[model samples]
Target: MIEIFGIPLSAFLSQLLLGLVNGSFYAMLSLGLAVIFGMLNIINFAHGALYMMGAFLAWMGLEYLGLNYWAMLLLAPLAVGVLGILIERLMLRWLYKLDHLYGLLLTFGITLVAEGVFRSFYGVSGQRYAVPDLLTGATDLGFMVLPNYRAWVVVASITVCLAVWALIEKTTLGATLRAGTENPRLVQAFGINVPRMVTLTYAGGVALAAFAGVLAAPILQVQPLMGSNLIIVVFAVVVIGGMGSILGSILTGLGLGVIEGLTKVFYPEASNTVVFLIMDIVLLIRPAGLFGKER
Candidate 1:
């Protein structure tokens, strides 16, 4: 067997592919967190719960409404966005008048209730969602067989991340968003509706998370506990990338995913803990994160 770095090349590549998929999810979720935190100064703990809701919504669409994967991709995130708007209007809206800690507590409580409601009904046995017909096969690349669904996930996620990065980093609206977060009162004085913008920003971040959830449904089991399981890991990625840099979040996510994947190939027992270990080391050495500015 041909090997690279004392490991079979096939094994190494396979783990790398798996890591890329995992990184896609991490990047999307952390992007949401970064956007919300940067703009609202709110640590939205409900993000993962909302992500679970998105997957469940896609599943329900297929099971009861005869909706296809494409439809779910378009509608699930919108549904999640609408729900996020409601949360902003009802709960988060009030916290803007108070300390940022209150916003964190409010969202954390929402996470608990959201996860609990789903658990009461789903009971966490895991719900299976089939990949769309178009993505159900495997492709042979001579050296290895790649699952179409996984490939699609990696491509789609990277595309979305780049689009988001371009939007915020290159476009005027992105500039305004960043500026508004820094000084909402000034932006408002300049004729921007900062409050509404703030709401939309949160909704946008939530939509990204929901979109990732829908993408994940067919590959991972749709279960109430899924979001909770992923939340801490994504948080670790956010910490390592810095909560303020969008590009940093995306890069760290994909890079960490590959590193974690390689760890699995070389040392399966340490794969799960590798990300956290990196996080601790990063914190000790660079507390502001890999791409974060020191405060």
Candidate 2:
């Protein structure tokens, strides 16, 4: 058996794969945060709550309506996105002209209320979500047995990340969004509906979080607190990657996951803290973040 650094190569590969899977989740969630902050300047403390709602929506749909994972993939986001739109129009929009802290406080309160309601109904126990039949097995890669579901997760995450990046970086609509972020009044002066754009952007960002939750359902159990557990790490990823850069979020998230995984193998005690350590180092060096432009 070939060994790398005195550890079996297969063991190392498995860990790397696990890290990549985790990074996928981080990338998607952080990307959503970046988009919302970039466009609306809202801290969105309720994002984790929205993510939890997505998973519950999926679970409920499955349990009550016989909706499969594939259908929930579309339905969950749409449902969550609509809810986000409602929040934006009815609640978040009024805060745009005020201090950013107000937005954060409101969202935090929203998080508390949402989490309390769900915990009351579901308790802390996780609900099971089986892998779809189409992706239920494992494949031998000579060195590692790669689970099909995990592979699907990695591929789906990467695709979504890339698609979002392109939408925000390449398209004409994306240009308008960026311009609005820089100066909404000017964009509105040019006849663009800035308020509408802001509302849609928030909805889109929320939908992205919901989409990630749906993706995570099979791998992680559906629970009220699942999103809360991961949201802080994801926020760290956003800060490390730079809050508004799409590509930065993607790369930083994946890189941190790989680093975290490597830490588990080489220094088990530091695995959980490695990402935060890197974030601290990055902040010390570039306060604006790895990809953010200094204001």
Candidate 3:
């Protein structure tokens, strides 16, 4: 058996693949965060809670409504996005002119409320979600055996990330969004509905988080507190990549995942801290983040 640094090649490859899976989730969640921060200038503290809600939505649909994964994929995001729209209109909009901290606090409160409610009913234990029948096996690669579901997650996340990037960077609508964020008053004077755009943008960002949650449901059991731990790591990713940079979020997420995976292989004790260490180094070198333009 071939070995590098006294570790079997297969084990190394397996860890790498697992890391990629984690990175995929980071990319999706961070991308949504970037979008929300770019448009609203608010760091949404409730994002993780909403993500938890999405997974629960999938679980509820399956258990109570007999909905399949494919259907829940569309429905969960739509439901959560609608909820986001309402939150913006009723609660968040009032705080736009206030300090950014107000928005953060409000969302944080919402997260607590949501998590508390879910935990009361579901208890601390996690609920299971079966992998879709279509993606229910593993394939043998030359160096490693790859689980089909994990591979699908990597592929699906990449597709979603690329599509979002293209939407924000290439299309005319994206141009308008960019312009609106830079100067909403001027854009409003030009007859565009800036307020409406802001509402839609928040909803869209929340939808991205929900979509990621749906993707994660089968892999990680549906649980109220699941998003709690993951969100902290994702925030580190956002800080390292810069808060509002779409492309930066994607690349940094994937890259950090692979680095974390490799760390697990070569230095097991450092696997958890490696990303934060990178974040610290990046902050020292470029406070605006690796891709952020200095303001």
Winning model by lDDT? 3
Q: By lDDT, rank the candidates, best first.
A: 3, 1, 2
Residue-pair clashes per candidate: 0, 0, 0
- Pull out the clashing pairs in model 1: none
Model 2 gets an lDDT of 0.91
Across 17-104, the per-residue lDDT of candidate 2 in tens digits comes to 9999999989988999999998898988889988888888988999999999999999999999999999999999999889989998
TM, every model? 0.97, 0.97, 0.98
- Please identify which of the two predictions, 1 or 3, would achieve the higher TM-score against the true structure: 3
Cα lDDT for residue 209, candidate 3: 88
Lowest-sum lDDT 10-residue window in model 3: 226-235
Write model 1 residue lDDT over 33-107, tens digit each, in one string: 988887888888899999999999999999999999999999999999999999998889888768878988898
